[model samples]
Target: MLMQIEALLEHIEFLLIAGIVLVLAILALEHKDLVYAVFFFGIMASFVAGFFLLLEAPFVAGMQIAVYTGGISVLIIFGVLLLPIFHDTTRERFETIRKKRLGIVLSIFVIILSGSLVFLFTWPTEIPAVNVDLAQSLEGLAQWLWGNHGIYVQFIAIIILTSLIGSLAILKLEKAEHLNPESGVYGLATWDDDTSEKAKAGNKSEDTVPVIMAQDAEEEGT
Candidate 1:
């Protein structure tokens, strides 16, 4: 009875996780706007990272959430927000034929690759003992990261920081250019009250001269 209950719980958990992943993927694909798509993709990546955690791959899961969901997704969202596409008033253009074809091909490739990888790896899987030495595993991972993989981790961090700063700089420049009169992007020429009054006075003087000239012409004709 206990074993059966455990099996049922596992099944339920799997189904719940699968449903979350599927929904997130669908949301990502169905959204027409880039910003919404990035949001859904981030959600999907986070859920996938959670799945990895359930599978006992804590390091891989952490990396997934950090790099794909946190770093890449944030960058994509920032780019989308910084661009003018978010303000578009027209309907979004559908994917081109070339893009559709490429997407289909990629989907097929992913399916095939996933199948092949599963087949290759699952058949030789010696069922290792379930005795997970949590402390030892964590220590080894930390050592590996700080010893050999440290430089790579630092490089990734630097790249993400650079991207963030570059986006901020671009946004700042765009705003400054819009506000600067000399830039002439969005600045409007504001006329002073004195200039307006002078223009109105000049118009009145021209009107009086025209009227006098007309009267003089009429009197000469009579």
Candidate 2:
């Protein structure tokens, strides 16, 4: 009787966690606001970590929390915050809106498909227990990452470095474009006040040069 009660409680806990994770996933994908989407994603990652813990994989759960919830989510949030300053435009906004709608549709489709699969499939009644030693697991993971799987780490580092270089290049180009008013993107030049004033002065100077040359010619003829 006690074992049945414990099993029932575990099932309930799993149900709650699964439900919350699904909800969070939908919110993360379908939300209009990028920051809110990232926030939901982080929460979903945390819930996934909890689900891993419930499966008796504590080290995997901790790694999920540390890698996804703590690192990648924070990085995405920062990117969402900072990217708009450089890329804020009507076209970009429209694209974002379109993508949000697409995301909503995809999320709905995925949920329906997943539910259908779950309904159609027969899940095993008995799940095998996992006995994990944290220290041994960590050591093995570290060895895998740094030894035979070292190429994967190198690839990831290269990708990150390439992205960083690309970002720096974009910033440099944007700065150069901002300095040159003619190169401003989509008629939106930063430092508009100063650039406009300089442009007006240049126009005035060019106009006066023609007038001054004509006056000099007329005086010489007279």
Candidate 3:
């Protein structure tokens, strides 16, 4: 009876944790404040680490907490801190959301993309039993690294570094573009060239109408 009760309690705990994780994920995605969203994500990551720990995967749990919960969270926070816009007290900038209809369409597109990605992930159907020699495995890894794998590893490192630099440049350029949108090929509305030209012509016509009206009034008085 006591064992059954304990089992029930464990299931309850798991359910509660799963609900909390779901709530945190929603909050992270939908939160108005970016900082609050970051906090929610960090907390969610910590809970995931705890979940891994519950499964008796201590090493994976530690990495989740250290790398995802701690390191990445700190990196995001520091990036926000470095940005001057975040420091501004009366910042009008808020996350721009797509129109509801567009979002719904995009959501469907995302679901399709996600399904494709999910199918691409190959899951092992059978676990093969093999005797793994710790020293031999390490030696093999080292030799592979020093040989054919070495070139690939170097290329991977270069790609990672380039991506990092490119991302930073994009962020900086994006911010500048936001500040001086005319300097870029795109605007906030990102109207096409023909649309912009039409709008300019419309504005000029509107201005000329006012001037013509003033001239008519002056001529009538004379």
Candidate 4:
């Protein structure tokens, strides 16, 4: 009897976890506000970590929290906050995004893709009794990252970061150049306010002539 009861309880617990994950995934997708969506995404990541914990995978759970919940969530939030598209009021910005048929189609496709992936993945029915020593694995990984292979990995990461920064800088420069009144991209000169003003001033100076009044002439004669 106790075995049957324990099995029932376990099934109920799995159902609850799966339901929570499903609900969060739907909310994250249906959410219109990017900020709210980010929070929902973080919550979803946390729930996934919970699943990893239930599987007796502490390292996976920790990494899910550290990498997805913390790092990726922060990056998403920052993208929505720091990017030009997010600088406006949420209504106008999202309304514009909503109007784009391509965006809508892409979003639907992604939702379908994610749902399909979830269905395709095989969820383990039971947790393993024995687990790998994550501490040793992590220690080995640390040594690999910071020892013999450290130089190449470090340089690769630096190059990637530099490339990202350079791309962002180029994008910003392009936008600024489009907005600039005095010059085009790459310091190319264009007809602008300064040029117009200078031309007008030159034309005025060339056209102007000194006039001598009759009264000035009489005073000079006297």
Candidate 5:
């Protein structure tokens, strides 16, 4: 009876995880707004991590949730916020004809490749015995990460940290440019009283008509 209950629990967990993954995938693919798309992407990454956890890969799952869903998603949101023009309006940029054609071709290729791979792979009819020792798998993953792959782990950490710093720096530069026109960070000239006067002078030159004041006097003499 206990074994049957445990099996049922495992089956339910699997179904729930699969459902979450499907929902996340749908949201990620269908969302139009970049902000909403990033949000759904984060959710999708979290669901993927959950699936990995259910498969007894705790370390990889934790890293997925932490690095991808948390760190990267936050970075993306911050970058979006840093853009001065982001708040002005919400409109989809129309894709060029060439871009549309390329996208369609790439999508068709992916569909065909995936279909062929699925059709080629044979499913085993025999059900393999499930490993009930979840703790053992988690321990093994921890050992592998800290022992054999510690250097690799450190390298990845450093990469993520550097990327975060670079993104922040770019955001700072954009914000500075937005706030100060005189800074000339993006080839933007300062708009002051002198600049306004220069513009008026230029306009006056175009609008002004030169007059020959003596031309009428000479015609009268003739």
Candidate 6:
């Protein structure tokens, strides 16, 4: 009876987590705000980590939380926030509405298809017999990841860095184009208000100095 109760409770917990993850996935895909969408995605990832925990894979769960929820989600949020055009309100509302709707529909369809596939397919029920050493496995995994695939990891990092730089450069060019339609470039040499004011002050001082000198000479002659 106690074992049955524990099994029942686990099923309930699984259902609750599954429901939350599904809702979060829909919200992440359908939300109009990019930041809110990313937040939902992060929460969904956390729940996925919970699923990994339920499967008795604590290492995978921890990595999921650390890599997806902590690192990737934060990077995506920062990238969205740092974008120069993030606050641009002049975009046409109708331009991407169709695309967004299509994406939502496609996502829903895909989810349904995947569910059907999972239900139809016969998954392996038997556990494979293997003598596994946890510490040795982990050590081998670490060595393979860092020693064998270190260059690939570095390449991915470089790609991410280049993408960020390229995004910034593209946004800057767009801003410059908006500022100067004819030249398609922003001129740094253009006089700003401060520069113009300084020039005016210098001219006024030069004129006033001559006038003061003339006034002083007139007084001396008198």
Best by lDDT: 2
- Measured with C-alpha atoms, the lDDT of residue 90 in candidate 5 is 45
TM-score of candidate 4 against the unseen true structure: 0.50
lDDT of 5 by residue, 86-120 (tens): 44234433234567678879999999999998889
How far in Å is the alpha carbon of 188 misplaced in model 5? 6.6
Cα lDDT for residue 215, candidate 5: 45
- Where does candidate 6 have its weakest 10-residue lDDT segment? 86-95
Cα lDDT tens digits, model 3, 80-167, are 6777653423332212334555777998999899999879999775437554455655566567776757888889889989989999
TM-score leader: 5
What TM-score against the true fold does each predicted structure earn? 0.56, 0.60, 0.47, 0.50, 0.61, 0.56
Q: Rank the candidates by lDDT, best first.
A: 2, 6, 1, 3, 4, 5
* For model 1, the run of ten residues with the poorest summed lDDT: 86-95
RMSD of each: 16.0, 14.0, 12.7, 17.4, 13.8, 17.4
Model 2 TM-score relative to the real fold? 0.60
lDDT score of model 6? 0.75
Among all windows of 10 consecutive residues in model 4, the one with the lowest summed lDDT is 204-213
Candidate 6, 1-222: lDDT as tens digits: 997997898789899999999999989877877788889999999999988767655677889999999999999999878876534222223334567689779989998999999899999864466544566656776788798899988999999999999999999987876677433123332445554455446544234556656665665566
Clashing pairs in 5: none
Q: Cα deviation in Å at residue 171, candidate 2?
A: 2.0
Better-scoring candidate (TM-score), 5 or 6:
5
> How much lDDT does each candidate structure score?
0.73, 0.76, 0.71, 0.71, 0.70, 0.75
Clashing pairs in 1: none
Name the Cα RMSD for model 5: 13.8
